[model samples]
Target: MTATYQELRRSDLPSLRREIRAGHYAKHTAGLGPGFLQTNLAIMPEAFALDFMRFCQRNPKPCPLVGVSDTGNPMMVTLGADIDIRTDVPAYNIYENGKLTGSREDITDIWTDDLVAFALGCSFTFERALEEAGIPQWHIDHDTTVPMFRSNIETVPAGPFSGKTVVSLRFIAPERLDEVIAISRRFPLAHGAPLHWGDPEKIGITDLGAPEWGDPCEIEEDKIPVFWACGVTPQVAIERAGIPLCITHKPGHMLITDIAEDAEVPVRNPRAA
Candidate 1:
């Protein structure tokens, strides 16, 4: 007889982070961490932290600031106890002079004292509610990254930070569109509702099959495409700024936090490292 084990489809917050930090799970974090807040990560030197903070403030829809790690401190006390910014995210992309230079799984070797890390709210927070309401999420069902696009809709400029917005797409059934919108709107921290739906062209998205990030979605005939402001918007701003060194979570690979969307205190798992 052989032991049987099925792949993980649901997990508690601490176990997920422990898995990610240990360099075991590195896939897109779309369907994982259900009901907990998943965040987009941006790490840069102290020199650019202020401008980037203002940038996130001005562009709240796409770049809602949730927590900022103290300068030179690797422990993200505000978001979760013992969460290591350098290794907790599933994947990381490194940028130099506004260009993607490389990617790494654990940035421990490159971590430095001058770096400051910021966690921005991600739309995945509202997904549990959508699931509870019986709204279908195509990407989750397909086990693919949500299709993301860079739009012509300009962001409000803050200091050296400014760029067009990025949005993630989901095709909703005509009957579920209103409920999905209402539920999503309630989570102000999670990009807060759809920015544009129906016409990708209106937002300068020319092709539905081709996306700037994540996997391309196969749109069903009865489903309507709904666009939501995305946390990935900061990556574009970081690119344009061209700071000497910057790091961000790979699109769709988020920093799973111990904080539940509604919980005031961090959730802990005694076994998690």
Candidate 2:
């Protein structure tokens, strides 16, 4: 049976994690676990860990590091009590020499002693906040993943990681834009506030109907598109870097952590203020 967002949202974290680990759920985790924090996953060889860590540190907006596992260990203690990086996420993208090879439900076969796992904050956390604040998410309303695009803004580079920023779009009624921004600003770990709103072209996005990732959402006549820095920014950087091998959660398919969405996250970048 297909699980509705409401059903999954009310489901316990342990059960959801178990279902995801068993490969029974591979769908985008938008409204699932309504008040729990969700994250983007990145796993790479230990040889590239330092450089990737530096990359995340430099590009904090799009790659806010929430949890990092010890080399070769799948347990992300900081994020959850029993979260296993190897099978926690619903899907994983496999990359080789900077190209996408395939996707898998589990990467235990490729898991090696020299690999490191990273968990980056995702905007889904703030989407719930928006909903709680009375701002409806059009994508979630229509049961679609949020639209994401590659933007014109460039990320600060670190080692082999460098690429244009990627952002997720959500249409907001003009009158409520300020309220949405205010609600989002509270979640600094979740790409705090809007990066750009009103014009997509100003950010080099040529078409609102076409998104680089996820389903295209309807932009009602009264609404304007608002953009937020996306966790996929690191995936773009990883692909461009052409690292020997890399793995990340397939876009939209995130790792749902046990942490509460409203839990206070220390500001890793004050400039976001």
Candidate 3:
């Protein structure tokens, strides 16, 4: 029988990590490991790591850094004791000369001493929080990956890292918006709260049925579309920067960390006054 989200949610962190490491689970990680943190992965040469780090620093909403690996080290000790940057993620996108070349279940062959890996907080963390708070996630209800789009909002540039922001969308009843925001605000590392909520066109998203990444979710007549800054923003920057080589976890496929969902993350208010 196929594993249900409930069953997966009850799974232990180490076992799930091992399954992902062994390439036994390569699908979207949205509802899995309910109490653990899930993160977006970015691996690139050390030469560009500083600029990318600065880029994340400048755009905290879209690229909040949760963990950074030591130069040439695959272990992300801060996130987990045995997390391997090269193989722990279910899948990875390989980019060459700023374009997607292919994807791999593991990148051990390309791992180099000059490489650096970064783990960015993903919305999955806050999504779990939302679920726990009784806020319905349309995508999860429909068994689809959350829809994401590239917004018109531009990110602050750092060296070779510059691009428009990317966001994930969820439909929520107007009455529940405040409650959802309150629950999500606690996770500063998880992109905080919604970036925009209402019409998709306002964010340069032309079609609600068409997303730049992930699956399109249903929007009920009584609900409004809500957008949250997505870690995929860095992938857009990498493409625009034309970096010679870059690797990121495939959209919706994330790196699961041992960090607890309720663990404290540095609080930086991303909301505008």
Candidate 4:
């Protein structure tokens, strides 16, 4: 008999995360888990959960919260049936005094009783939706990580969680911009709409080739640079939040789950084409 998990082309996400957790794979999770939801992970102490939740609520554009684990628990039962918060993500960064000190594949050895995990919806999930909608993603096409940058735009504060919004940049042709906008808005759980287009410097980006995170993509003359609120925004916030200790999924390595992608609902944007 064929394994049920193996039968899924890109849909067998839980097993994928499990393999990633066990050190079977460590690479960018861009095109994997076609129909399932993938998220950014941020683990901090329960002491700051309320403020962080409010930070997400107040600044939904950059910090759309998708799932939260109970204090001291490594299980993210709500996000996936057997999700283990500490080991499910492909890679993790440990921070101390707001500085990244180390990286890990799993955090079970260091997991503490007071830690809480937050899973924020990521654009990878919606990008899969966009592909299904017949929109092309240039970064994927060029085999490069999506470009990201820190913006001049400030996020609403909740306690210590505050900073300028960081965004992932994509270049799309003029003919497809309208359709991209329409498809993205349907996934509000993820960063719903783009923040800016055309000029990167208008958002404090000095150079398109030099990115704060991820690999840079080459832009063609016919394509324009477009920016969207990214899940990495929380990493910037966690830095500003000044938490003595925190952990987050390394950029591009996400936590994939069992959500359907083709089930996207049509969303009409009044101001968008």
Model 2 misplaced regions, further than 4 Å: 1-6, 266-273
Task: Flag regions of model 3 displaced more than 4 Å.
Answer: 1-7, 266-273
How are the candidates ranked when ordered by lDDT, highest leading? 2, 3, 1, 4
Per-candidate clashes come to 1, 0, 0, 0
All candidates' TM-scores? 0.93, 0.94, 0.93, 0.90
The most accurate candidate by lDDT is 2
What's every prediction's RMSD, in angstroms? Answer: 3.2, 4.1, 4.7, 5.8
lDDT of model number 3: 0.86
Error of 2 at 67 (Å): 0.6
RMSD of 2: 4.1
Worst-scoring 10-residue span by lDDT in model 1: 1-10
Q: Write the per-residue lDDT of candidate 4 for residues 123-196, one digit (tens) a residue.
A: 88788777787778877776567888999999999999999999998888899898888888878776887989
Q: Write the per-residue lDDT of candidate 1 for residues 110-153, one digit (tens) a residue.
A: 99999999998898889878888888888888788999999999
Q: For model 2, what is the alpha-carbon lDDT of residue 115?
A: 91
lDDT of 1: 0.84
lDDT preference between candidates 1 and 2, better one: 2
Error of 3 at 261 (Å): 2.2
- Please report the TM-score between candidate 2 and the true structure: 0.94
Off by over 4 Å in 1: 1-6, 263-273
RMSD of 3: 4.7
